[model samples]
Target: MSSHVAPDDQATSGLDRRGELREFLRSRRARLRPEDVGLPSYGRRRVPGLRREELAQLAGVSYAYYARLEQGYGETMSAEVLDAVARALRLSEEEREHLVRLAQPERQGTPQAAPPPQRLRPSVQHLLDGLGVPAYVVSRRLDILGWNRLAATVFGDWAQLTPEERNTARLIFLSPEARDRFADPERTALTAAGALRMNAGKSPEDSYLSSLIEELSQKSEEFRRLWARHEVSCGTVGDIVRMRHPLVGEFDLVHESMALRGGAPMRLVTYHAEPGSRSEEALRMLASWELEPRR
Candidate 1:
């Protein structure tokens, strides 16, 4: 069936939830194999992941019904049907919620507008300044709003780069040096892309976000490929992150993200190293490398 934009999506949701749902479902489906769901391996399949017929069988629904829903044009989907699909897909809480929103955005409530990324309260800046390790604040669009000296030393000096270059998503996908900074580039990009997807759902009309995505899609082939997968994630375990900083050759760091009080949408992220470890020593070295910003 053709993936036509639903009238409801056109009239109400402006974030392309139909396309999101279609790819999300297909991506999840593609990750599974016949043996994964206890199904016997059958004839050779042209495409990867479980076939539509196989999934339908597992979800206790007809192939036609499953196909239509997968295409993101379901009509009055029952709660039971959704629950069954969730179970079949083995989706986590966030993934299930995302699915529900895409399947029936009409049921979802209107979300609040995200504040300006450049606007940070003085108190929040103080909190960043007080942090011993690398710390920075980010918007839903992943803009680097506020950051301390440590962040500059470790994550690179955003002052030198343009405002758009400071975005985590942009840095991860568009810049090769930034991608090399992370130990697991693929995982980093995938999770960041997922977070961007989640953020787009909430703020569908953000022009900056739209432009950033378009630029990445056009510039980087890998970003375009990963974006097509529709894999989504809120965050990843920061402990797995190993940064190859210029001052410190290789140091493992754990990231901590907190929602500052009165800052509903803005978040502060701090990096920490294990106590008395080599990484910790490297962090100290990084701190020493921090220089005063030019007047």
Candidate 2:
């Protein structure tokens, strides 16, 4: 579980963090079956795992009240109620802390002021160069901070855009050109939007994030629908991206993201083809094209 803060009611404010927390907790609980958490699999259960009534019983709350809480209609729950819910769900220490953080926003101070603008370190740049693949570093806000030659070749149009326009989520949702570039545009868009949703919960006050969400909501109906789904995914490792590059046609590549140790606002992303596949040939071609000196 990631950290989350309470949301302010102001329009200028970002996501309602408490709302996010309630939704997250509810979603997590809804997925568990009784057998999943060592509960007895007694008679024909109307629903899998613990029903709302059973959960309410365990937490010492009325079913109506627990339903209200899950619906985000009940605020001001006592710490005792939260603890009971935590125990019922078998929450770990970290998850319990996260729940408390969400329930009691006043306890945590305002998020730290946005960090200063920083560039990738020379050593990190060199490390990317050595990888000799389509690689780049991005901020939590999906800003492209730096990239090697192969990345420039693969995401050239995106890389050439201004800082305000370089966001991956924005490209997936707002740009028709970007939408057409992916083999399965809908899946690609949903995945990108879901990743952004995850980031929103992690850093609710990010100005860039707020701007990106506003832009997408206004510009793309598809994005708006997907955003409302509240899906969250961290594309940290082993995620596959299917691309229909104008130059390379079609190829499937595995993507991985690694946080740079002690480096603020930078995560390295790299892509590679599965072994003994046509994607390998496509990657080699991409590299050759990248290696050529430009005018």
Candidate 3:
């Protein structure tokens, strides 16, 4: 099979890390009000959220310094300064980490090289085959690497999708079937966007990753809006995903993701229905059904 990387598009090859950091900081600041950070609301403002000078005051930095930082001159910023800005913005733990990543990509580590085609180990595939619940493994890019029989039954057959189409972000944002299957497609979109944003911060130089984000941003307006929010998910585990399976009707399943040890940054994601609930019965029915062989 061919690599999943999109065809070479010079426009989307490299991420503008400084641009990302500036926008992220701006987004975080835009969410807050003068009152939110204990500053008194003053005269009518043209824009939403606290003013730049106000944020500078809150972060205990000069307005000129903060303005430069917001304009993507953060390469020389100290950790203490970044931390202060994070606290001032009232960023969540994941958001804080994301801020550090964007502001100090060099400090974080070397930009990762483009990874080779990902494959699941035989033992990992065996583990999936043995599982009773719907389960799949996904790469750091949210690419579907492997899945079990029940997962295919519950989530639609991944075997039907092209390698590029197997990505979770692509499924959520680009697939018409996903809009119908997900109980809250909007929430799912937000989660997917957040995860992608976090990954982009970590590997700003990854061409495939940059291309995926560009495609999603251009194709999905909802994804574009969510991406602008600058939300980040340190891990993929998210709220209970309520799915409306075509065969089994509607059911809620708790989602969990864990990184596979001693390997690439692949995560094993599993969905389990609450015990003794109608959802469990639905899942059981899916497991019992004889799924058609993969093409």
Candidate 4:
């Protein structure tokens, strides 16, 4: 049986894209000051953001067109115009890509229903087993599909949870144990939101993902607040992450997220502690625990 998207859902999605575009443009504009953009701070401006006219002038586009762009009607804006605007705004690569995705969402096309799960390859499992560090495979939706023993030892034994509960975002927002594992829950939660936003853009018609977001939003006011910000991050924010491990106390570890080759939508994330550090010692203990035979 073929799955299909309802027309009402499509309408709602259109509204969402437009609203997201409006907010993202407004937020980006608000951060830039006139002097920063080399524009004269002629008079005391009451509004916090760059004026539409100023942006239009910067991008070498007409005021009417730029105004429409800011109003979330940039669906027809040319690529060159968008590039100019992105340069004027000094947007990062990721931010620029996100702007394009929101403005020209139709060009990318949305799926009719949720995508099927991408299973981990046996090679990937072997690779994880050979690694010394903690590593796990996760889908774009943050589902912890598969994990090695070391990852299990450091992060909770996720094998205990159902497939739905195994999701990283769900755990971060809904599970007390997961929240407690983070050194700073608020920061991690925000990171989760950004990650989800990025993934959602690539697969907008994912009903399972949509349900996950609704559930999280309903369950967590914090999730709702962060999601409303509409920030999309292409990857992890930093090289290092601070995790509070219940077993070995606190850890400041570096992480690497590698996209699995061979057209898989999953990523393999590995956490490494600096050599000879307390965190490294903790990892050694974790490895030892992994080696212990289960009853």
Error of 2 at 241 (Å): 1.5
lDDT of 2 by residue, 190-243 (tens): 777766666665567776576667667767778767665545665437878887
* Candidate 3 C-alpha lDDT tens digits along 1-295: 0011223212276667777777778888889999888899989998899889999999999999999999988888899999999899988888988888878777888867447547789999999999889899988788898999998888788899889899989998888885677888888888887888787777777778877888886787777677767678733465588899878889999888887986567788999989999999999998889887473
Candidate 2: residue 113 Cα off by (Å): 4.6
Off by over 4 Å in 1: 1-14, 112-115, 261-264
In candidate 1, how many Å is residue 178 off?
Answer: 2.9
User: What digit string (tens of lDDT, one per residue) describes model 1 on residues 174-288?
Assistant: 8787777777888788878788777776666655566667676667677767667666665754644778876668988887676666764777888899999999999898788
Per-residue lDDT tens digits of candidate 4, residues 38-130?
898777888786887888899999999988887889889998999999998888887888788778876656534335666677888889888
By TM-score, the best candidate is 3
Stronger candidate by TM-score (3 vs 4): 3
**Comparing 1 and 4 on lDDT, the stronger one:** 1
What TM-scores do the predictions have? 0.88, 0.73, 0.91, 0.86
TM-score of 1: 0.88
Regions of model 4 farther than 4 Å from truth: 1-15, 42-47, 106-114, 291-295
Clashing pairs in 3: none
Candidate 2 at 191: error in angstroms?
2.5
* Model 2 alpha-carbon miss at residue 164, Å: 1.2
